[model samples]
Target: NSSVSCHIVQVFSNSDEALINKKLPKELLLRIFSFLDVVTLCRCAQVSKAWNVLALDGSNWQKIDLFNFQTDIEGRVVENISKRCGGFLRQLSLRGCLSVADASMKTFAQNCRNIEHLNLNGCTKITDSTCISLSKFCSKLRQLDLTSCVSITNHALKALSEGCRMLENLNLSWCDQITSDGIEALSRGCTSLRALFLRGCTQLDDAALKHLQKHCPELMTINMQSCTMLYPSCSKSQMTALWFVCLAAATSQITHTHTESFIHIACVFLRILEAARCSHVTDAGFTVLARNCHDLEKMDLEECILVTDNTLVQLSIHCPRLQALSLSHCELITDDGIRHLSSSVCGQERLQVVELDNCPLITDITLEHLKSCQHLERIELYDCQQVTRAGIKRIRGLIFNFIGCCVILGVNCVLFC
Candidate 1:
């Protein structure tokens, strides 16, 4: 309340204008203005030229968070702030700033050379020109989010890789224009890169994976959801069925051909892999993944209908540290597949979260198989019609609340306790 009163007096000085101005030093006034939000600071700037200068000081604009004012942030507003911030800005988040265009981004890139974190998520108007400017100026950038920036192509990625080698985390999800070439260039240049989100990038194939395997040794997380072209075949169901049929005869041959080269390179640090809806990834592809990515802790294979018990068995045998696994909508998986997973060393000792949502074929027997999994915490069986309340009740450490035949289990049950 006292702070609000002081701010009011600082702005609306009446007969005591001279007294208030003489009493508070400029340094003290600037410090007080620093505590105010951007909107409040803008209001203070309207009071007087002295207050305007202090409110719009470079120190006050070091980290401009426009997320709260997403609807209000326009190209002119960002451009004006960039002009004022000069070189002092370190973090700028314009997430969902629909009106932000390439010109504003260009101005920000030119002025804020020291910016380390920039979030331009859903900024549809931005093009490759912004990326070109950023690559030329923002060399210290560590985290960049260009999610849903559809116009961004390989040219922008090439520029970024050549310039911002310090980039650690990048989210390129929904950037459909990107391909293996740009990803390869990035991996080759940004050796320190750790987490990459390529979800919905349909153009990326095994070639991109090979590039990451060869270059990014420190890479830990990769999300390739909806990348249907990663495999050689177009029809995921037929290709997977063929792979499963030939699995016995071709396991050694496929492993020798595909995994021998980069198996060691990938097995070291790769931890999390989410390839949901990538239908082309069959047992052969998953075999290479399971064999190489031994340190994989979390994996999501949602809607990957081709994956059979063989892949789960391989994951169980190879990835002893495996903890979280999601096989949602994978119609091919049966109790036999889950039994293999539960019997595995990792499943018995370390597996914690398991999501089998929409897996229609899974019965109560599947839950019975999981009794030996002492470390098991949470199991999601949403829409699994075959699993009855009595079957779910048999599992120890999982207590269900039966409310009119609807079995609801607390998410916190045994998992956190």
Candidate 2:
């Protein structure tokens, strides 16, 4: 009799739980749904009134990650959300969303004034109008990532320069449309800028960087990866052509060939050439560079087809304060250059990160000598055809095979990571 009563009680409890789920209040459901993603939260509006209120809550609408949203849908959603809940928003990521027009961006800029981080990567539709509005409203913005946003011209950047004076980390990678005027504006306006990325922005030449060095004295880290223009080819003729290109590109007017030539020669020694996609940068150009920027601490000669081990030898000897070095895809660099690097005074103390990617000339012998480097932290030898298993094994042993460090245990200090 007792066992039968217990079974009946279990069935009643199961039915009661189902009844509670079915009769749950809409407000309670919405309150519980506040922690969902934007997509999921928007869908919860179909559930009931309480769910709708929760979805529309100003606090819950602060962060908007529209990376996966459809462009047209994103525009409509942003319009609705901006009307209802833009005041409390702190972070907005519109990465790769193309439908965000000037109007929608303006709405965000005006309404979401407290935004801290704004990522607009690959949003090619944004023009100077968008930036102008952001400047007028988003004053407290700290981290702004504008990577690959090619449509943003100088006028919009100038607006940002005047507006976001307190900006810290600003990424303009692949913004090929930006020129010296934009950089000059930034240097004059946002003097507090710290970290800046100009990767693949090939049009930024030495004039802009020199201006930045003059004004933005507080700048700490500047990633100039693939900015071929800054590392211009060292020659009177090349410099003349480069200046002509810069002038013509900036003013939309052609320059006199003779005047360009004269200026090129006058500024030849002042230039610090980068070996990025410049096939003409040979040993001769490096000789000029060595004479010019003897204080150069960071050098990257990636894909510089003309650079040889002879140039590296000279660079290691001359650039004694060199800290970070990238010689990736320079086929001419060999064990001779590596040996010179290992024996170099610069290589022993200051060198931190060395990228020898795809250089078939490097071998196990290079690894053996790299162990001498004390400050060396990151070493990228990705796809080096000559690097064998034995070389990597030796590297692993050096980083991990410490006998006296047995008490310290599992601290693998391999340079690759």
Candidate 3:
């Protein structure tokens, strides 16, 4: 025991000398510490007094992703990180950090004024006040992910609109309290906004979208899934399922809607659009989208029950860049829809992902159509009862998918399988 203690002291003495004596420059040591993750940096801090200063230095704290420590992370940790990181903190993800609250975030906004990207996704404890702090201080903020932050309301969007003008991407998914007022304010101030995700903001009507189309010309990606009252029919007093102007009732031909608000949003050259579960969306809505958003690369129409082969025809004819398309649960999508999509220039060249889940009508003929899709990488056929095992095995490289990569296939089979 005595010999072991003596060896430990000698090792510490050598380590101290090695650290103090100019064996490695301080700048180089800090640079090396910069490469270390949060957990490793914290461990290195306990190594020695010199190591602690290097590990905790503001320059080394520019980017931090605390998703791994979501459950353990508290407001105090954020406060300390803010104090240490200061304006040097550029990007920090507090996603799923459930315990982080407003007070610590206020301190963070004040201290880390230069922060450009901050993710508070699932941090539901904080209210609009935290955003007020950000609006006052963190004006340089660009991207913010507030997914499932149910407490956030119109006030926070108002604050952000007034202060954070440079904001490009924002995810307000499941923030049900946000109304058209907040969206209008956001559209007016943050015209530079590119991508806006408002999944499940059920209250916003067409008037809210009119504001976005009016101002945000640079907008590319927009997701307004499950906003039940999105496309309000003037004839009917009640709200409707078409939000994000996402869909309309199926028509034999592609016809434009008379709704002024939904028509205007077509000006946005969006690349990625996910309007899943807007069940009422039909050919008219898809036509408007396909005609306007020629740049649309990916679209999710899952559970859009009213959608038919006509929507597919419009997409293939217009959206030449169409790569990924989801028609899952749209039972109206017959083999002809797949045939039209796969035969076109967009289908053969650009089409990569096609999800036909739960569409009972599609037979082996649908698989035959998809064979021409040279770039087709993934096809979600889960619960597609008509498609048999023989049909799946007939496709080239789909066997490889069963072995590795993307989703597996089968009707009445496990999702991952």
Candidate 4:
């Protein structure tokens, strides 16, 4: 009986040794596993209780991209992580996490106000109420992406501008309901605004830009691309001087048009221009850009219907070192413009990246000419019906896979097998 008891004890001792002694130190294990991609790292969580804790810790969580782990099940998991992480989060990305409602957003905003980067793209359930709450709670907002948050109105922006004055980078893109009034308010309030993307905010017009020029002087980058209403071409030459003054006066009679005109005339300087969807902007407005902003790099003349090939033919002649140009949706641009671009001063080399999205006029003939460009890295041809598959056959393909199926297609912006 004593011998039988000794044998059982020996078996148990061996089992404990095999289970615990060979286990790796948690710190060492996490250090080794942190290099793995999100998928492989997530698998580590299922290994044991120790691993699950390590994987969800702030150190490892910082690198794990939330954009990839986007499923109905993962929403609750991420929220739980937010609650567990306390205040250690530096960058929080909840992009495309549809289940994260206003309450979850408020919880995050209130807790993670110290976040250096926050991406709330496609979080449709988030309304102006969330923004109002964030204004009071999140004062350290630097980089914010409110893209596709359709419910955000002027009230939300007003709240943010009044409170989050430290905001340097803001993307209000695709918030179509936003008007020039909201933009004017932001321009006046967020004086430190560096980069503001007003893309697809159709209600923003010339009045907004005029306001920005007056108030947001420190603005380095502005993306008004596809802002169809603000198309400078739509505004009459007379409105360039009259509309802004009239609107400002109507609001508060701050300064009369004639008085502002005299001041502008004394110091003739019109620096920034982004007349992408403005079908009315003729060579006249472009001539103003060519004269001023000698250091101007970005020019988006896409879908400016009045801007014929002749306009570009002149712009290339004047703006020699133009770096980024997007001539998307400009159906009128022909080989004449492309040929001029191929040989002119602002030709391939001086130009770094150019977007020819939906410009049917550009074929392989133009693309082949563009291949001569040295620094050109990205070329967006999303809906360009004319570009055949042969155009980008040589470029290496990257797949944005979601679990098993790909959602964003690929470089060409079309369905891929």
Candidate 5:
């Protein structure tokens, strides 16, 4: 039926119902058009009068990701799209589209009431007004990404909480203006929330974590990277010191925390947790996390310097579904920690990625212990000065991928191709 459009111009006018129905009917053709990207769809719209009508169908614009047009997308274009697609638009991503502001989003929200997944990350010009509009209109909204939307504050969270009750996943990463009050409001209202990303939201302390844990019990995934105020286990003095040091360095990497529903490892609930660079986080914090989040499949504890081998023991014993772990820069972690992880149930069947980069305490013996992790695919040991070629060669078979890792041994450096 690929050639059914050969008589494209005359097909629409064909009086024979059977002849037209047997050929590429409008519904099936639109279904085929649904797969095309914006550029190709536009080209198809220019093919002929028949194709133009078929191609411009709003049903085919239900899910649109304009992330590629970050620099080129204009507010006029966005407004035009809102009118053209109207209620047919369900999911749209204007991620990094700085040109489109509150005006365009207001129009969009009014037109696309059924919008479920909206990514406004990097739309810095937008403020609480946009959220109010979305709250007033888009009740069906599910996942909302406001990453790097600096103008967003507690007021925005308040609006979203009041309106978008169905919201399940939200990314407020790098929104420094939000506080525990906002989080509490969001947690209380969005009780069905599962994944929340708050990396670099330094104002959020342990109080915010408590709010999420108490209200959002269904929460399976969270990113608290660079959220130094999270660890309540640290003493006042330690917390103050960590607050100063971590915040000073938080802007170093220009990190972007994605709240995109954490890796869906388990069909039941994708339990992924990331607390990387939470320098003040002690073993007590991780112990609580491991106990409560037993289904945790992926965890990033990189630079959580206060964590010791006890943290590993807790994870190994409780979190049997752990598949990926990053212990980079956790100097307290020794070979024993790796052994504890490698001997666990996760190591036997689920463990896949182990990043131990910059852990000076670990020697070549850590590699030997990792051999027990049958499913281990990548082991990061890039800067363990004590590790020799002999030790890496011993466990090289277990770690099959060397794409992002290399080791320095003596005068020679081993690079994986």
Candidate 6:
């Protein structure tokens, strides 16, 4: 009996020894470490020397998201990560990291040469030097967000265009210093670009847009909110030249007109356009956009004082895929415009959200026209003084089949049913 017990104990000891000596593959270890957060990984580094090396391995740190540690992400921490990651880092987001300056960016640029996605939004201290460093080193970069980085100038854009040829999505929103020259350079160089955000970039004008039209034939989304300088105005000479070209093409042959039209249509691929508060954009400019960008899905023309019912008519006719539209503060839009929109095939089928905030001319009849918008989900009628409680109740019942109760302008009214 003692011999049998000894044999069993020996077998169990051998099994335990084999299990203790088992070594996991390095790739498996790195994959396991990748699941841990930065804080947890730092803690794991203290477990042992092997664990420390594995925790700081470059393969495991390919995509570092330090957005959660925005306030705590200082230059030192960024420098340490950059040093550890080496060139394997593919994505790094330091959004709202106020403490991160040019030094941290320089560290990243020097080490992470293969970085493709970078978000430095609201990093106020980063300047043109950082851009130069990124452009020089990270040639494979694809998406860069420099939103509210006010210090960056045209030099940064020029560097990006010259070096980062693969850039696709760029957000220069609130970078106030960039002008048509920088934009022209970007359009000329970055032909693969798809989406561009230039909100509050007040220095840009129609010439920059013309450059984009000529160069960025694949552009899908462009946001120029508050870029008041980009007015859609063509000189008489330009208009005459365009008309003469069209006429010549038409008179040359039937195939010539078709070829010219095809080229014009193929150049514009804009899907989403936001030009809110661009007070300079009139009927002429809006018409140009409507004629070119017929595939528009979402459009914001809020506070565009020059846009009247004519613009709506054009949009209703051309933009068949338009789902979300904001015409807020466009006082010129009356019941006629709403009627035209509601009566349109696209409006009845695709129209979803409509904002008419502070539109003084809109009356109760606008709601009656909107009843035809079967797919309409939400509509804002804030400060439309002409709409009465009776009209609101009537429309609420007609549309929603439920009575909506709300207070607007000190009167009990149905806002949206």
The top-ranked prediction according to lDDT is 3
In TM-score terms, candidate 1 sits at 0.74
Q: Predicted candidate 3: what Cα RMSD to the true structure? A: 5.6
What are the lDDT figures for the candidates, one per model?
0.74, 0.66, 0.78, 0.62, 0.75, 0.75
Best by TM-score: 3
Write down the TM-score of every candidate. Answer: 0.74, 0.61, 0.82, 0.64, 0.76, 0.77
Poorest 10 consecutive residues by lDDT, candidate 4: 242-251
Over 294-382, each residue of candidate 4 has an lDDT whose tens digit, in order, gives 44456666666655577677667777777777787777777567777657666655766667777777665665565555555456666
Q: Which stretches of candidate 3 lie over 4 Å from their true place?
A: 1-16, 19-21, 232-263, 390-417
Q: How many residue pairs clash in each candidate at the backbone level?
A: 0, 1, 2, 3, 0, 0
lDDT digits (tens) for residues 195-248 of candidate 3: 788877877766776677667867765666667666633232211212233432
- Return the lDDT, model 6, position 194: 75
* Of candidates 6 and 1, the better by lDDT: 6
lDDT of 1 by residue, 305-362 (tens): 7778888889988888889888988888889889988888888888887888788888
Point out the higher-scoring one by lDDT: 2 or 6: 6
Q: Which sections of candidate 6 miss by over 4 Å? A: 1-26, 47-50, 231-268, 280-292, 400-416
Better candidate number, 2 or 5, judged by TM-score: 5
How much does each candidate deviate from the true structure in C-alpha RMSD? 7.6, 9.9, 5.6, 10.4, 7.7, 9.0
lDDT for 278 in candidate 6 is: 53
Q: Model 2: residues >4 Å from true position, as ranges?
A: 1-36, 43-48, 200-202, 225-228, 231-300, 304-326, 336-364, 367-417
Could you tell me how far off, in angstroms, the CA of residue 234 lies in candidate 5 after the best superposition?
13
